[model samples]
Target chain A: MPTDVIMPALGMAQESGKILRWLKSEGDAVEQGAPIMEIETDKVTVEIEAPASGTLAGLRVPEGADVPVGGVVAVILAPGEKTPPETPAGVEPMVTAQVPPPVQRTSGRGRAGRRPLASPKARRLAAERGVDVAALAGSGPHGAVLATDVESTGRGRDGSTAGVPRTPPRLGAIWQRMAERTTQSWQTAPHFYLSREVDAGRLEAWRASTRKRAGYERVTHTDLLVKLVAAALSEHPHVNAQWHEGGIVAAEEVNVGIAVAVDDGLVVPVVHAADRLELREVTARREELVEAARTGTLRPQDVGGGTFTISNLGMYGVDAFSAVLNGPQAAILAVGRIAERVVAIDGHPEVRSMSIFTVSFDHRVVDGARGARFLGTLADLVEEPAGLVP
Target chain B: MSSPSAVAAQPGTRELTLSQAVNEALAEEMRRDASVFIVGEDVAEAGTPFKVLSGLVEEFGPERVIDSPISEAGISGIGLGAAMTGMRPVVDIMFGDFMTLVMDQLVNQAAKIHYMSGGRLKAPLTIRTTLGATRRSAAQHSQSLHALVAHVPGVKVVLPATPYDAKGLFKAAIREDNPVVVFEDKMMFAVKGPVPEEEYVLPLGVADVKREGEDVTLVATSSMVYVALDAAEQLAADGVSVEIVDPRTLVPLDRETIVASARKTGRAIVIDEGHRSYGVGAELAALIAEDAFYDLDAPVRRMCAMDVPIPFSPVLEDLTVPTADTVAAEARRLVGKE
Candidate 1:
């Protein structure tokens, strides 16, 4: 018997997976459990192994084809088995024709027998919208009337009701997911923002001295804030909780996620148990996570199980900005650029390095007073860097 | 209608193979009711070649789980006679193709006992059988004959696709007053799914929407439910959304759910493992067309096995049935996506 190599379901809601490339070609002898192809899902790219040890035959879909989950992309035949005459019945060919064959209809029929070939939905919509189905040209198979045709009639060109020419931009999977998540968070989560400005004199000093060290040369302000935020979260567990299924559930670990921008969109890779790690270890993990995010090679563990998140746009020269909550998580800390400011101290002018920190909280989980206290603690730690780093 | 997540969301749910689930349902029901007993061929020690009744003989003893000879008609008659009395007898037919031999006892005797008696006497019998093809069991053993019994008036038929449905529907079948026949896909005995630990039963004559969609409705049964689901996923990539409705029970079929889905989608395709002519698909397509005619965009289509015997050759057998590709292609054509 031959074994089918199917496109496995990698996620709960994933519809299809794109085949990146095949490691082995048709008629190649392969061993079971060996990596045969790489597939990219919405979240990660993973290697698919050969289901059976045999000669790989009957390669159905080619690389770059987005095969549906559980669709047979190839087959593995036994050593003495022969390939079937045709592609197996259920295996979908990726490049089928978009248009269907013409239907054979009798001509010379009157309006009584020759009713308009409109779908039931199309007819209903046409009646509702007061559009004539006979005057519209359909793009559906066999040129049958469709709902879109009815909707576009008496409208602007190409179905644009705004009377303006427009073309929708195609987005990658990552960007599409980001758009959906941000919109969902904004609409669903009741957000409340708290902004605080703290003197960044000690934070800048900590980064400078740490960068001068032998192994800490690449440490940035984001790494320092991750360390301080993890400490503050350990003290105030309420802000580290998530709003899940209409209740507040506290996370067990203080895993902090850092938002990093990539070529396509943004990714939040987490650093597990940040409070328990030393500053050097935290710096090393942060650098590794950022590099992985940029290269699109972050593993599953690097992107999941985050209790709190931090998004810092300070490096882009922005003063301050509030961010949407990275949801289920109750709060997110947004950091702005650090600049020199003149302030009155004891009736005299003094120049100090200052940075703004804004925290967005899901009001369902964290109230005003709890969110204010958490930001106050984070600001205090940013001003005084005594034993918090160690 | 139970969604896919409802079973898993239950507390203390555990994964069990379809065989294990059936066995557990039988054991629980036998323990609950003293009058309940199972009778079939090789049921005691052999466990009917699938080991579904492995521990039942030991737990309930051979007297209750009686093993009879290789006689379908004789055992069916005995089960009918026992059911006509006060006892609740469960008759296990090994292969659905052998339903031909026991047709007189099941159709003529068991199905008509209560009705012929004018509700004075009752026949509470549950006939469990296996249905499905492509097992290479040759023409004698591989056949989906649920449509045959469903054609009759008094016999109730059910086809369970998943382990969760199998256990729940089987228990419900045993408790019903009328004669209910359960057709389990022979190829799906090893398939695993979540079954709740708590006691529960799924009422007959209810349908489940396995996957919800907007474009086309694919009404599938038994093994074909998985096929339709696979095709639905593939169609989703081509921008066609396919919804799948599993009619768990054939007789007293859930017409409202199937018609509502067809009315919403405006297109429907019925897929079954039985023969294409006068099969389950024909009945469902006729019902949907009758109820949702104006709501339909295209004629209701039927996808079933070719009107021929199940071939012995693997090559020919693969071509006789409707697969995911065929279903997807048919859906694409119906929704004008092709």
Candidate 2:
């Protein structure tokens, strides 16, 4: 049986990588798990291991070529394998591959699932492009395919099916899932956005006093907000609910996933039971996550399972913006920068500092009233953070 | 300060300028390897833009030291073609600013050909260009454009500071199978050091520690190397010892050396001649923050040229490029002294 070598995602958010070095040469016999190539994505270099033991057949993209996630690069034909599948002429290879379906759906076209013999991602790519995988011969390791084979064959991933789309799509596993889930959520759920501009006057004064008292060792506003959110979520557990097929599954623990923007994409590292941790602990955890994300070294534990989430673009000077709800998490709170604005204080126009927080929720689970109450409670806690202590 | 070996390893042993060392390296490499030839403007009979290739034509025959028409694009193209044809051609592109004209040839052709062709074609070409403000060549000629070449995929960019590295690294570039761009500071060429007479090939993508200290790690490339070393000395006087590192090649950047230094010092400041905006200094700052986050006591400070083109006026040009004073100030800032 031919084994497919897909593009290995270097980091959690990396959809693709540039081939920096090729360790193996054509005709060189390679073993499974052997380092065959070095790829650089998001400034970090990672070695790509060979999948199946076989003689190196072909390299689709040369070193230094930027390929999308799930796109194939090389092929290792299975021993005794002959006549690599012929590609449809004139089809260009996609930079990225779509997420593989849970099960192979045999679309009448015999070419489904066979992207050229490049990497594992490339193989999944054939199916995503709707190319006939079976008809396309792989030119990679252990009879695996490559992306160029698809390009060389000239057939779109959908395998000459009209309305299946001839224009090649560059989609990765996460992107495919993100798009599907986002579109589905938007279409079905009645998403109502509730944005509140809260006066952070007292909080700012408190933070300033704390910094002076602590001798220049100051904590960021995000740290204080995380504490406030944790307390608020505890008060309004209804907003922290997730939508399931049968019913709403309200999570028992508060695992607040903090969304960090890296060079590639978004990676949310969850702080488990944020309600139980101190402000210092939250700051330290967030710092560690940001570092890990920036360096492309985030562990699997850093990305999985969250009941609530927070994304801050305040540091980048962004005034206000909405964020896509990271599925499974019912609500994602977006925080913007604090600026001075005119407000009615004691029935007179007074300058007060305020910051906007926009909350996007899975309307199926979190109702507008629930989200509003959560934000209102969060605003109160930030104004009076002393109440956050147990 | 302690041992003879340690004392002998110090970067400055002679007053030879950066140009003199480059000339020595070129002459020595050409003499040692008959396959080595010199190309580019004024490189053969006219010497070099900085006179780094002055005596090569007199020593070697015109075939090995042939001059070409004034075309920066043509110079690199010929070098790349000849390198592909199996000749080690060292091209002097005169100015770092002029290299912009041949970006396609350098970045697309020279850098990608070997990798794109899957190692079928080898381009053993050396591009020697002068970088930095010397008598204010302005935006056209005087500029440290290492970042441009370093960002390219296959090309190895060598910005050697000392005479020893200039000789050793240049020889290494000539022998390397890939194309290399040797960026030398016009001012540093006159600053000499004692280079060994024996054959040596200092591998690219490695860093050299000019001075070792415990307070902060100072990483500077090319001419900024001397400024960093000088800052270290000044810092040492004030009870702050700065460890200075020069990454000889930027492409296969030696992360190990940089990270180790950062770890030791607990604070880091990167100095580069490139502009401060998204320059090599930014890359180094990110690298240190990523690897040595816990070790860092403060944010990494970068001393680079102001985000402006090198001006024609001497005062403006001097201010634009990172000076010794600026390097020292950044060093102090890294350690929280400023």
Candidate 3:
């Protein structure tokens, strides 16, 4: 009989481990108690030994792939035994095998047991999302797993939520805000859209050179967009004003909300006073805010008091998309990718770098002509932003 | 009845007490090499009171099996000088407590000569000593101080629990060019085991698996090896499989065998006859905890002598040291099989 080499649990919270290296090659004879592989998990490297004396055969879950604790990674076959003809690409071979039952995470909130220390809310969130709460290291009060911990661990894997739900719960603070504000804005405000294509080739090149010359480690395209949007709003204040109590309220502070999408919902952390700060300072502040949002550590002051918001899907390879008004804000700008496109140059076709910027405005607050004018001004400023910097 | 795996196999077998095995090993090495000699207080005339060096003087003659006065320092100094001058001298310290009398010679001279002389001189000496409580020998004659010798550098320490290891490891110790300390369990001198007829040498610094099972790995040294084996039989009747590993040599400790067995089993129980604190079990427990912690399912447990002096009363004496029943109980707790 061939002994199954299951992925060893490397820690109390480790459900799986990524194989860092394989010391023994497949089809090689191995002693019963020899190190066959090294696995890295939870920042620790653990060497795993073969379970039986045999020939290592049918390599599975190749190096750099993670295998769950109970999932078989490889097999040790007795002498003269051949690799099974029907062995799947990985062990626990056979894609048609009966799916194993869901692992019942130790339940109950009491301390001093196998059950992990976690709040009821965290447990509920993990259950709804189908996440293993025990596998997460808690960052809550006294290291108790919280709802936010589940969300961050899910996002860390970036859509590799193999066992997580396809649809998360629609009840977190961020989720409720999206539900209430979008519903209120769509039901009450008269909305209108205006879009314009801008050539951003010069802005992109200027940003690259500026960062290299200044020796700044990170200068993103979003920083330049915030500066340009702030400049355009200064030229056209109506686009940056809020509609409150049936009156136009122009914001004294140009606090632009940078909408960062996390695993479960989107959080809009503000880059306060964007128009006044230098480009590098804006880049630094904006980077800090986005990091706080992704790590689920944003404080109230970070997310409050936004006059306008920018939702950029450029990183997702999207050409353009529309965004709903975050309530009370006059408009939300949806920015798309800068890619080479065929366009008219004096009636002759030419390839130039272009991007789409669409403004979703509250029609009750700003008329069609004013919204169109705001987009046009924004396009001109973005195309030639040498004057906006410092 | 002993478990089948608990009894290690030998090629050609004969029964011998642990002391007889040591005597045979010493005689064989002395005959094989002319430079090999024995020197101690009662080693030549009275044969160590335990008869471990009984007939060596008659065979090798008085020059090679030289007797000495009650001066441990003087005796140990001569052994170190002989070793440096290319003689493989085996110095027997009649009792372990007298190690204090020869501390300077043993630690500074014998242990540091090679390093102090910048490798120009080597102390190829073997010091034979006895440890463990024998016949309620009280605090003086009864002590397991292998930890003290092991803590010193430039010295290899060996503790053999069975006759087979006593014979094999003693021969290997004589062959090593570095200073090696062979500590036998004083209480287990009469313990018998199967010995191979032909000469054989078991390498130092390698652990032997006295028993093999899957449930738990018990790492024990010296007399505790027997305690652990006895507990293995007890646990076997209760349907718990246990594996016992004896780390024969302490200085160049065999961490590979001990850690591998613990990782394989995922549960480790360390049993030692030394004191509970600052003893051999503490070191082994720390090693396993640091190296194989993730492989453990339950906490690593230690079954060591209570942190107190060995008592004179037999009843209290048994309580001071780890027993078979205590080892089995610890195993059950660690396995969560209680």
- Candidate 1 positional error at B225, Å: 1.2
- Scored by Cα lDDT, where does model 1 land? 0.84
Ranking by TM-score: 1, 3, 2
Candidate 3 stretches greater than 4 Å from native = A1-390, B1-11
Candidate order by DockQ, decreasing, is: 1, 3, 2
Scored against the true structure, residue A135 in model 1 reaches a CA lDDT of 53
Q: Candidate 2, TM-score vs. the true structure?
A: 0.46
Error of 1 at A209 (Å): 99
Q: If you assessed candidate 2 against the hidden native complex, which CAPRI class would it receive?
A: incorrect
lDDT by residue (A1-390, candidate 1, tens digit) is: 788899998766778887767888878999999999988777666788998999987776655556778887778998889876553335443431221222222121211113446777778777776666655556565666777676656453344453211212235556766887899999999999999989999999989988888888888888899999999999899998988887889999999999988888888999999999888899899989988888877866788888989999998999999999888788999999999999787999999999999999999999999999999999999999779654
- Tell me how far the alpha carbon of residue A22 in candidate 2 is from the true structure, in angstroms, after superposition: 54
Assign candidate 1 its CAPRI class. Answer: acceptable
| Per-candidate local distance difference test | 0.84, 0.73, 0.79
RMSD each, Å:
27.0, 26.0, 22.6
lDDT of 3 at A172: 42
True contacts kept of each: 0.62, 0.00, 0.00
